[model samples]
Target: MPNHQLLNNMTHHDVKIITDYSTDYGDNISTVMTFPTEFGDIQKEYPIFFRKYPDSEEFQAVVMLGLFQNDNLFLQAGNWQANYIPGAITRGPFAIGFQDQSADGGSEKAPVVHIDMDHPRVNTEKGHPVFLEHGGNSPYLEHISNIFTHMMDGIEVGKTMFAAFKQFDLIEPIELEVTLEGDQVHKLHGNYTVSQTKLNELSAENLQALHRAGFLEAAYLVRSSLSNIQKLVNWQNQKMQQQVTSA
Candidate 1:
């Protein structure tokens, strides 16, 4: 469970967060939730896929980092090798939370920044400070705020994008069979990817709608990102070779 608390300068004035990526810091993720807004940069490094949400059964976009769970190949000697890290990963222990507010004779929920008190990155001794010595938000905190805003907007856009894809029947299951060194076989299931066939078959009107909504390019980006799977395989093979040589 996450011990999330509303971030406040007074209570967390001295809080510092680890900004580096490492397995020790719990960055060894197989996939990270991504949104359409990030597809351009994420597609440059990771294979984009869709998975059903456990509770809502809604499709959500993600960028695969490794072939299996807890197998982030991008982490090297406590450094993330990728040129662009997903905003979900870069946000670290901070997240957007909601607070009830009364506005204009009505009640509404407002987004607030929350921090995980138990995350490994949360500390007082080292890393980037959340607040300045004079009780103001630090540059790091400002960056986190910006990330939160973008993430929130991206989430709304992602929902519309996925809905459009589903309506057009453009998503299909992705199956992968991999043979590692020593004939170790791995089978992956339950992930979905954009269907090039279905996309190509769409009518001109639908294509124009998708183009107007800015989803046509995103679909192509997702399709092109599938090539990154080969990159992942090479990384895995390299690791296996190193292990065999060391042994």
Candidate 2:
């Protein structure tokens, strides 16, 4: 369970967060959740795909980080090897929580930042400080706050986008088979992608509706991001070759 505490500069004065990537910090996943709000930047490097739960038909977007399980090709020596790190990865232990902070005897849900004290990144010494020595927001802290805002707003955006996807019957199952060096093949299942066929077959009125709602470009972005799957395959091949050379 996350021991979430409402972040206040007074109570948590010396909180520091380790921003390095490691398996212990839970960065070894092959995929990280992406948002429609981030599709443009995320699509530039990671291949965006959608997935549904075993019993749930609702689809969520994720960006592929590797060909196989727990293999994040973008992870290097304690650093991520990409210019644009997904907000989910960078947000670390921070979360946004809503509370009624109306001192005037009214009800208004206000978003406040919460910190998970149990997370490995939280430490008293050695890392990026959440607050400066004079009790002001550090650049890193400000950036994380912005990330939380984006992620929170993305919830409704994603919900409506996926609902539109279902309305247009644009999502279809996808099995990505990556052929690496020496005939090594990795098959990724339980993933879905936007169907170009379905997109093309949609009525002009439906296309206009999607376009007006700003979901059409997002759908195309998900499809266009598939091009980066080859990049993951190439990284896997390089890793395999390095293993062979070492052996």
Top candidate when judged by lDDT against the true structure: 1
* TM-scores of all candidate predictions against the true structure: 0.96, 0.92
Q: CA lDDT of 148 in candidate 1? A: 84
Deviation from truth (RMSD, Å), model 1: 1.2
TM-score of 2: 0.92
- Candidate 2 residue 232 C-alpha distance from true site, Å: 0.4
Residues 55-89 of candidate 2: C-alpha lDDT, one tens digit per residue: 87777898889877888999877788888999999
Per-residue alpha-carbon lDDT of model 1 for 209-230, expressed as tens digits?
9899899999999999999988
Candidate 2, position 131, lDDT: 93
- Leading candidate by TM-score: 1
